[model samples]
Target chain A: MIPTIKNSKWLPLCDVPVLDPSSWRQVIVQNVREGDRIAALFGCTHNASVPVRLYALLARDGQGTLSVLCTDVEKDYPSLTPECPQAHWFEREIFEQWNIIPQGHQWLKPIRFHAPYASSTKTSPPIGEADFFQLLGNEIHEVAVGPVHAGVIEPGHFRFQCHGEDVYHLEISLGYQHRAIEHSLIGGPNKRTLPYMETLAGDTTVGHTTAYCQLVESLAGCTVSSPLLRLRAIALECERLANHIGDLGALAGDVGFLPTASFCGRIRGDFLNLTAELCGSRLGRGFIRPGGVAFELDTSAFHGICERLTSVSHDARSAIDLLWNTASVVARFENTGTLSQAAARDLGLVGLAARASGVKIDVRKDFPCGAYADEPFPVQWGEKGDVYSRAYLRWLEILQSIHFIIDKQERFVPNAVQTQIGNLQPSSLAVSLVEGWRGEICHVGLTDDQGKFAHYKIIDPSFHNWFGLAMAMRNQLISDFPLCNKSFNLSYCGHDL
Target chain B: MIKSLWTRLKQHHRTIAFPKQEPRLPEKFRGLPSIVQSRCPKHCSECVTSCPTDAITMKDKQPHWDLGRCLFCPECSRACPHGAVLFTDDYRMATRTRDNLVIGPKEYGLAQPLEDQRRKLFGKSFKLRVVSAGGCNGCEVETNVLETIVFDIGRFGIGVVASPRHADGLIITGPVTHNMKSALEKTYRAVPDPKVVIAVGACAISGGPYIDSPVANNGVGNLLSVDLYIPGCPPHPLTILDGLLRLLGRRYSTSRR
Candidate 1:
């Protein structure tokens, strides 16, 4: 049996098969060995009488199918990381959340410095106080940065074990941006829920909000109108265009290429303004709600929007093309932070980072949903798995997103923007996967008998790709850390949440 | 090099002449809100009930809007049958005091200039160090956008410094989570005496949506004396710029009145 459910479809919670821990391990390890990926691995400790139940959501990209399997454990379970490297972070998160230890795990530490949700009897370790791996050679030294960085950015701690100028390892400790979003989300779809989703990763407003709304719609069995779907897709692509352009500019600035850097900085604002034109906020807040979008794009405004897009598109291409043609920028970016395709696959990297590393996986192409199903675009990718590929892949994807948005808008139809979102179906689970600009954004919701969320697991792409960044830093110059870091552009708040 | 110069000319000088020339926001932009209680029917608590952040409170059947707590969402506006609650296109909602954030269908004081001594000290060449305690990066991004070519806040002699010791003030974002409390305090203490504190976004002012979260406090709340409070889910770059200019006593006609 396939044991799979279609994307965004609700299944009875009781329908999931609960296997023994060994069998669960066998199933996950077997599937992963056969090219499946772990989309969401979390535990729910709702029933106090029963043990903490671990749920594994496995994705088979080529088949466009997802399988769910669960197992009940009292405390420790044999670690899967020994056999399947992709489950490393998920297992650490599971241990942190449920106090269920994964014995024999290679590196066990708190991913986010919070007391275990299963029990709060023990005092949790402080945020940046973990034992980071260190080297004790004659010329080796360690450098620590942040929790309060120099730039106007989010907080997280980075420790580099270096020998002179070369970096041996980079370990990142986060939880500084932890706002307890998931903790506050229990029994929600409340007023706080939409705002939480909107600000989940601030920059990914439309992508994350669309995922949350999809989960709600699936559980409530509400269907979005065609025009609304097109509008949502446009907003999402606008978000991608803005962030990718901004990152490209930052990358250029890092490499001392001033012209493209300066142009991209302003051009990014132009794209954000386009989103602000669609709705009120530049970040696309208040634009997406449960049943549908908050604002509608009028027929009259379409021409002006398309015009603005064309102009911004022209500017973006001109600015980014300079980066490719510049020898200095290309030399700086070429081999600074290389991650092998085999390593990327082992770590289960997703989104642009995965694509840049030559891993042919994209939720939009593999597991199509919403407007993506009707108007699919070719997945843009690179083969080098280095800073150059990551930077270049963003430009490729930006071109695709701009084309996709313009195409969708040209074929735009007018329809009701919102419909009534009914109460969710009781005792069910729904999964939503969105191709956010950063990567795959997975939101899985399990509802109680009263139709309130019992457990809401949000997996931002950063959770999967942060390790990839750390791995990329291996054997690179420590000074190039900022360049590699910006290349990945992982979210601290998104991961800590 | 020729291509670089050509691209530069093609991009043109992208900076806008804001403050001197009135800023142009999109028509759909939601900014400062107003309440017309007279249009409201008796015993209607619809707006209050619809607010996600409890930014609206009904006392004696009158809706009091708290901009500090508001996410600027459309739920309250849509639920108001009387159109009592409406968001104006006015983005100059930053305030000088926390109490001024809560208003009941009346005009409130916008962010006032820093008292004479501090303004004189920072009026020219003001430097700030931004600390993101627990922000969602919305506030941080907009604050960073102020330095971009379009806004070009540096034109006013204000810039972000790498260290707090070199800063004249601190621009804070986030709801001040427990993990970041000590770091925020250390940064605050690092700045010299007579330093200013500007709290940006609804999150920094009133914890915005994360108010009362177990792990996060109500922003900088009473932790530090906040000199200015810029309000929004994430304030627009223009809104933040307006607040800073106002604090420096650099007044200009904000809107096309």
Candidate 2:
């Protein structure tokens, strides 16, 4: 049963009484629009997907609900887009995937990867539009950058509509690194399909793997061994710490502090080594198995790990202190790419990206999974929502993560992990939200004919935050592009895959 | 001023004669895969399955681990619920045979003389740039640590460069993804001719476990010629540093300082 935590503005309106397979959609045509008052237009997901949502808040009027005016009705319900502007991306994404016609929506284009959704047949028809985000500009010169870039970077194309240095309306064209990981997961057995999911993006292995497994666990209505959950969380946090340090160092490097960057990179590298020592895979790739973990952290190994982490932490702290006082490094990140809290929320920014901008929403804290469900560590949040703020918060979060690791590892006993959950029956339908280093990782899973996965959709925080990144880059100089991009550190492979 | 002097003092005695001597490896070091016969469950196929890049293949029923393609992710070992595939503590898997690199029960022997190899490698220093294709990041992490103060790869004249143009050799990591293949080619192309390419980690060498996937692009040499290859999911840092040292013309020496 989907438990109701609290009555929220949107939850009640959208909640289907019972979410059976057929009841995949909660609201019918009449429920799409409330009354006279027009609400905001949000986003929607589609194809290789189940239901197409025309999500709009209704007005609190005669029906005493949130009201929204919709001019164009699909099936006798007033349209929603004219009321809300934010729904544009969702509409475009839906149209691009499922071919749902959003009556009065603007700027319908591809959001995920730039592809023709899937192979089209003559009768079903392929939706073709003239240059989707092809909003033709007046005398605007188009500058194309990267399917391959200069920095140790992922492949993405940024077509900027700029005059000189200042970007006017920026268009981010990513999908160059599409691995098609999801489609490949279908035929294999549960455990065999996992390793592929594990490498969706190397860096996000544990986070994505954890989310994937957790969803399956939830769907199967299976409960994991406690030790396994704790270990998963610990491994995930370590991965988060490692990535945060690397990005922080790289961001500093982008700002021209080579020494600071090198030091941070070195420390981050040390953390990765520690991961290999404890788990055997530096990036925690094989750490997560379908039903539960395959290995255990030996006492001596944990001690060695804690010792190494302490040494690295000390070395990193001294270096960070040096970096903080270092005039050059501090000057580079401050006051750049200022994303206000309201703007971040409005844009649906998540994870550290949103927290950096002052909207503190950590799934670990808010939703509470694994060890975090029991622990009471404070979540680090920043208000400036700028490059510096994000970097600083990342540093603070790294510290918190390290503390969590030590605390968790210290409490771990040998032979504490007893048994596996004998049965991994495919789950009915489940959604697992974990706070990945990047942000909120929301995964939805449903079983297929033979009780295997019918569909599994992962919304990496970067998917929502990519638009925010483009927005953050707006009005900023060309030089700060890498800095702005690094703040988010969105995974192109994870997104593309 | 005071802290700068302290850092300088710490840097002063950070001497490591890597080519002249070997260094310690971490416990979970993702070095080149050496198939241990004693540990193999014999009938288990978990390691073969755990591989995301397909660097491991079963040959005549026994596992044939191609070092040229292994990602060094101890996923095989970790995924071995039965402890069938294991990552041994032995970090010295360097050999002359490209075939010898595909270590399994049949190919676990170390063939190279370290001291002489070290002397040959320490002949000069070389800069390297490490790029990951679709690896689970085991290799990239180890590559990143080559410069840590302890096993300073710089002592062997091996440094990591950001761009391929500045690099004397390219240390390619990960299972070759379709996306990274072009970038790998472009990076190789950008590097001046006569530059060496080193496929570090099992994934780069042979796609680790992900090769057969729709995403992988077979081997590193499938696109570009690689002079030397370091196998491991994330090969032990010292081993990686040692490989770079060997490639820079230094001989590999197992002598401890």
Candidate 3:
């Protein structure tokens, strides 16, 4: 039986007994096949004599348990991708970071073309220059787009192998925005650390910072006040509301639905404005600190937000409803880019994209933390994994999130905002999973013997779902690529980090 | 179709009346930061230490803040016991010269428009190609906001085009990453001669938080000559709009009566 840690904030890495490499692989493969998703898989090197220690964090959604299984490996180990397809990227990442190869792992490629952490033997290949799977037939032409695009979007390369208008395969190559954020966090909880977490993924500032703060607080054995936790939940849901609204607007824009596109865009700013009212920044930066929150809401400020939220919610609902009622929008959305439920499960997709594929997994509901533990939100899913379902799922989530925010506002109690965070426990590991607007944002922090961060692993939801976007494009029309892409709206920098 | 037309008509003119009137910013919105030199204690490094981006430096024993490099987190303001650093709601922080970004005790003016021949050539209609080398999508989204109904930058005859070849200038964002260095250079080269590069946000000016990172080359300033520097962690849409308008020698009358 794999040793399980109840989802809190931090757990001692030593409490998770290190097994032999073979047993570790067996445990992970068996558990993952039995429904557990690999949350994070990373290696940490401590001493010169000791081998690199590998940690596998498995999130058993049904049980609300996070099981930690670790092993010490010298060079290489048998691959788990053949049995569990979710292990494909994780194994490749392990290989890229430590020079330990995953034997028998098919489709071994660098996830991020960065220099290896431990060794200097193999020079890192240039970004987006890796060998991609090519189609070898007449009429099987390739179309490459970005690290730069027409729209003012983040940089990431997309290679599509197409037969006429129908796309046979699409390979997304990122790492253009890999800012060495994780590497910078080592031995740091310093002033620079929180700022790094805030901008880890700019749009998901609250989500990532919350995860980082939670991990730090958990490591320090500190619990924040209920009011602060409630406010954070509200801010997080506000972030959700804004992004979902913006995404819905973007989806409409993709289909040439002008009314919803224009209206939703302005309404999105309204929600962001509400966040600005809470904190100074629209993106919710510097609001979520280590122990708790940086700001507190006064009565007038609180009521102002409540009043603004009501109007924005009404306008947003009206704008989004037009999307469903309009035939042209629905026609473009439905069956455009579909990912099967089986494929979603195989790929280990999370968040809204996963839910759209009928996979009932939400970090907030499954593994409740802070306010979620007290007042949980319902799990919303869609049967069809098409662009339409994803759009509809976002709309559904927007309504639910609005209701959640309004409800939280009514029940909010004024109290101390931030608590004092003590020194972190040495040789401990903390895993924080936040359901960011994009999806599950996992930050795993392992502290050294000196109570400083030894290795920091940040697994953005984009990491799991970017592959799902690629899978969705299979047999899809080339023109619908933009629509399918917007439905996902995966972060380039988030994945790159 | 009639109902849609009526709906559109009822919506009326939704664009913010800028260049004829000042835009409305939220009360809590942070913009230009002003430093009070006298309030700073002698040899106290509180504000300097609290600054995340190292934007604040002590020169002549007075803390000078580089707006281009600032994330505007307000940590320095909170860290200072004497209340030396204060942020104003004035969203006009963009500047023409890099030195102008370093604010001491004295007040600084807005970025002046180009006096070159290219300004007159492109003043009527300036098309820009935006390149996000290593942006976090904050600046990208805000830059996109300029095209939306409320902002609607097209009225000024300034718009973002897809290709650099068809553009008059490049409005670049993000810290230039090593991976995107070649792509950014290639895109810049594609733009015709007499093109200006306007670096937006702190990242594009000084790499923001990711400045000394091995993976990043700080900002586009290192690679290209920046004509205008609009500063913010991610500059508010209004700040960006004002910067663009000011750069074209067009200023909106203040709506305040």
Better of 1 and 3 by DockQ: 1
- lDDT, residue A323, candidate 3: 78
First chain TM-score for all predictions:
0.99, 0.82, 0.98
Candidate 2: list runs displaced more than 4 Å: A1-117, A120-143, A421-427, B1-17, B30-63, B68-85, B92-98, B104-141, B147-191, B234-236, B252-257
lDDT of 1 by residue, A1-497 (tens): 43687678779988989899999999999999999999999999765667799999999999888999989999999999999999999999998888899998978999888888877697668889987899898889999999899999999999999999999999988989888798899998797899999989999999999999999999999999878888888899999999999999999988889888888889999999999999988999999887788887787786688889998999998998888998989999998899999999999999999999999899899888889889555787899999999999999898988888778666777646699899999888899999999999999999999999988999999999999999999999998998999999999999988
A124-158 in candidate 2: lDDT tens per residue? 12212135243355765666676556544556668
Q: Model 1, B83-112: lDDT tens per residue? A: 877888888888899988887755677877
Task: Write model 3 residue lDDT over B1-257, tens digit each, in one string.
Answer: 55455545554567887756766666667778876767767589898999988998998888888998899896888798888778878888888888889887666757888876977978889999999988688899889989988899998999999999999999988898888899999999999988989999988999999888888888988799999999998899888888888788786333233
Ranking by lDDT: 1, 3, 2
Candidates, DockQ: 0.87, 0.30, 0.73
Q: Lowest lDDT 10-mer window, candidate 1 chain A? A: A408-417
Error of 1 at A300 (Å): 1.7
Ranking by DockQ: 1, 3, 2
Stronger candidate by DockQ (2 vs 3)? 3
Off by over 4 Å in 1: B252-256
Count residue pairs with overlapping backbones in model 2.
Answer: 62
